[model samples]
Target: MVNLIRNENMKLYRRWRTWIMAALMIGAVLIGSFVDWHYDNKDAGADDWKTQITQEKQHWKEMIADPKTEEGSKNYAKDQLAIGEYRLAHDIRPESDTMWSGINGSAQLIMLITLFTVIVAGDSLAGEFSTGTIKLLLIRPASRLKILLSKYISMILFGLLLLIVLFVVSLLTNGLLYHFKQLDLPLVSVDSAGNAIELSMLGNLWKSYMLNGVSTILFVTLAFMISSAFRSSAMAIGISIFALFAGAIIMELTQPYAWSKYMLFANLDLSQYLNGRPYQDGMTMTFSILVLAAYFILFNFVSWFFFTRRDVAA
Candidate 1:
């Protein structure tokens, strides 16, 4: 199993697309950090912390009072108000455009990693079949299960490697662009009671990165299942990507229906729990986790069954 995994890893990393994806992630970090530094420098002396918070608080209050505001928007503003007030009370100034801020900001780019990984997952099995390499793989000593499992494991590791690279590069590039003076600073977050609590900067960043993993895992599993069930890499990749985006749109369109809460994409983003919000009123973190786990199991069952039972000669 170890040798099989190693072989799969080698095959994955040796591809030119793998290196190109890494370069794109590194380049994104550099470019985003540079832009952030430029803007932070411009705003550095524009207003004092207290003044900015005061204006922000006033804006939130106005948003709440506005009749045209949506329920979600008002709720979001209320959460922002809680955090903003906590920052003011604790003096956790606007994250100071530092390396740490860059690291936190880079969390947004996790979707890029997801996109790359989905393509890799969707292609892994189907591409082998498309190129007539699956026969060679099957003739090896390893069982079909081991080969498929090894490919899935390697794909996951590839995604993790990209994530680590993003964090490290963001830390280094932003450290060089700005400075690492705010290493001791703590992040302010709202607790369950809508009160602000201080959280370690590193702790918060890790949580943010892991929250992103929820979507990555779900969609990658979808791509993996699609790859195993189909012979065309293009079909697998295209359908998976479409579903990823379409899920969000469907959720938006079906917000009024109670059944929307049960949709796979609706529960994929666990980040909503971190901020004390769910897409719907009755949803919870535990519930979302259960839903995701159920789908994960279903996808894996279909992938394994179809991959093992079907004849490659077709």
Candidate 2:
């Protein structure tokens, strides 16, 4: 199994497209860090954070008090207001464009990581079949399940490598740009009960990456299943990419329906719970996890059934 996984990883890295994806991910982190530093570096040394918080509090208060404000907007404003007040009372400054802050902001780039992973995963099995390499793989002494597991594990390892690259590049890029200060800064957020709390900056960043990883794993699995079942890399990649971007829009459209909570797209974003908001009123982290687990099982089952039972010549 280890040798097979290694062989699969070698095949993946031998392609020019894989290196191109890594280069692009690094370039994005550099560009984003530079842009943020250019605009916000000056404020990193500002001493009037208390004044800034006061101003932000006033803005949030105004937003909350406005009669025309939507309920959601008002609730968000109230949460921010409470958090800002907590910061002032506790003498905690809001994160500026510091190293840690830039690292945290760069978490958004995980979407790019997901896209690249989906591309690799979508092509992993389908590319083999399309190129008539499946017969060679099947003739190997390894069982069909072992071969499939190896390919899937190799793809997941590649995704994790991209994630590590993103984190390391973002850290160095932002550290150089911002001089690596405020390593002990705390992240302030409001809990479900509107109470403000402080969390470790590093811990929060770790949590963000982990939660983002759930969606990445799901999308990669979905692409892999499509590739295995359909034997078409293009279709698998296209459909997975479409779902990645359109999931939020679909969730919004289906938010009014109670059954929408059970939809795969609706539950992909486990991070919503961390923000104290579920997609719908009754949806919780546990509910989303259960839905995602069921979908995960279904996708893998289809892939296994198709790959092991279907005729390669057909």
By TM-score, the best candidate is: 2
lDDT of 2 at 299: 94
Structural similarity to truth (TM-score) of each candidate = 0.91, 0.93
TM accuracy, model 2: 0.93
Clashing pairs in 1: none
Screening candidate 2 with a backbone cut-off below 3 angstroms (N, C-alpha, C), the clashing residue pairs are: none
- Indicate the worst ten consecutive residues by lDDT in candidate 1: 41-50
- Estimate the overall C-alpha local distance difference test score of candidate 1: 0.86
Query: Top model by lDDT, which number?
Result: 2
Please give the RMSD to the true structure for each candidate, in Å. 2.5, 2.0
Candidate 1 regions off by >4 Å? Answer: 58-82
